[model samples]
Target chain A: MEQWRFIDFGLVDIRDMMAMDEAILKGDGDNTFFFWTPKKSIILGFFQKAEVELDLSKCKDYTITRRISGGGIAFSDDRCRQINYGVVGTIDNDLFPLDIIESYKQVCGVLIDTLVHYGLNAAFRPINDVTVDNKKISGNAQTRWEGKLLQNGTLLLDFDIEEMLRIANIPKEKFLDKKIASIREGLTWLDRELGEQRDMEEVRNVMKKKFEERFHVRLKTGTLSSNEKELTKNFLPKYYSPEWVYR
Target chain B: MEILKTKPGIHKARGGLIRSFVFVENGILKDITISGDFFLFPEEAIFKILENLKGTPVKREELLKNIEDTYAKEKIQSPGTAPSDFTESIMKALEA
Candidate 1:
């Protein structure tokens, strides 16, 4: 049986995290965990073409990067976002895709428990999204490699909807006064919903506790190994290059 | 000619983002237009790349390779902008 681990990093780059995942896939380290990113960033899906999904002119003024997993594009920043990543070994191949979906359920259960603890109505939505009162609060994506599964998700602690709308180039008709109001009606924030602002550390602690309780495993704190550092150095440039980032 | 216009699912930013229109004629890629708010260095360079890519087949791997090679020659680092970005955007449009 493999042991689970928990790591909390304050602010890190999406590129570094991608590199670490690549190293883990290559069998360079044990299963690990960490979360850190600046206030504003957009991570594109692995197979996504960057030009079509992002306003590159707008992104030039912000931090944007490509991720290793496949999914839709997502925006995250300091005030409204926290990243939680988990890597586990000892996966059962016989389960295949079911294991992948079940993993989401297990992790989302922790989030639901934490939200319930905080007195918020939260539940797991199918195919990888967590919602509160039928509005999305978090979106998750996953990638598997060599008997290991790396699942990570973004929790919306606080987000700037206007900024999100601005950076992503939302359709302008939606910007009309009443239309914008209608759009806002469909979105919710944790700070607003909970009636209090929650800091990153507080959220991290709660999620860590809930994850341990739900998975029935102990989590240890650890850092990326030397091999991981080497892998990242080589991998970062490739990931950052147009070859991988665009195509 | 079969022309299809669609949003590239890969790039997630909202406004003035690039949209791809793929033109296939006789089962071959006749042309593709990647238009939006992205900036390309030496703006005309994008048109030049597209002009050259006009007659290529609509296959995914070939399109990716040609786009990659063309951008490498231009010394353009990020393709998420104009021409190169347009190429990637078109590929994603085709996939979707």
Candidate 2:
């Protein structure tokens, strides 16, 4: 089994989480699976126009940052009900197949196996989403920069659709005429599926075990190196700056 | 030649959005700027798409073929957005 690094920095601010991602990708780290969640924030995809995709008036109360990754915006909060993780490394056929789609399939396959371990059935949707009974439980995005790849995503232990709607303009122009029921139909959470709230530590433990078995890798738990810490500190300002968010 | 500003045409594809700003000259795409909430892997594929459409004819079939060819050449992975959706949006802009 190939060995990889596993780092868990719990419940960080959005900026540091963003910086941590870049630090690991910029430096040499064994194919790493890193996990973190922002206390509460709305993260915009790299190319997403904030004015077009979000309900700014409602979001005025929270912190907003744009991620270097690609995909739709996701609303995360202090609720601590969702688990987020990313795989950072160069692709090798031995670990993850080189094709982007296949790589997504591999990572999501690990998630699926994890969910199954929790007694729920989950499947991956094309490109980058995982669904339970066709309702989204996870959304993933990938980026390849300077030959290094990063695929980051979130797995919802539970979510609040009302809160999600408040933060996003996902509703159509005519959607105001309808109720929020359809939005709920599009997404689901593990707690909802299992009919109970799950502890975050429990989820993390299960995820670690699942990833280990699925990838055939012994995850050697490690913390950020001094060099990575220095890099993360440098990236912090940019990640937190309005120039990067609005740029 | 200075290009005139025109209204952009927007289309909702299967899984994302596409907004096309097209400047046509004699049925040729003089300049096109595409921006939307769509997710694309490698992200630079957006610039490549815009670059490939420079000087492409605005005709539906021709534009579709050019877009498809460019996407093929770039090995683009536009998960929810497809070349046909982009071409259709451009055609709508040209027609308008």
Kindly report the docking quality category of candidate 1.
incorrect
TM-score of chain A of each: 0.85, 0.92
Error of 2 at A129 (Å): 1.1
lDDT of 2 by residue, B4-96 (tens): 246556677754666577888897888876646667766777777778888887788888888788788888777667889898878777766
For model 2, residues A147-210, the per-residue Cα lDDT tens digits are 7688889999878788887677563521222233566667789888998888888888889899
Q: What is residue A10's positional error in candidate 1, in angstroms?
A: 1.9
Q: After superposition, how far is residue A79 of candidate 1 from its true place, in Å?
A: 3.0
Candidate 1 ranges beyond 4 A from true positions: A78-81, A93-97, A170-183, B1-21, B27-96
Score each candidate by Cα lDDT.
0.62, 0.78
Worst 10 residues of 2 chain B by lDDT: B1-10
DockQ scores of all models, one per candidate = 0.06, 0.33
- lDDT score, candidate 2: 0.78
Q: Tell me the tens digit of each residue's lDDT in model 1 across A125-223.
A: 655668788676776766665566666677777778776666664544322422344445656768878888888678878877887776666678877
Task: For candidate 2, give the lDDT of residue A160.
Answer: 75
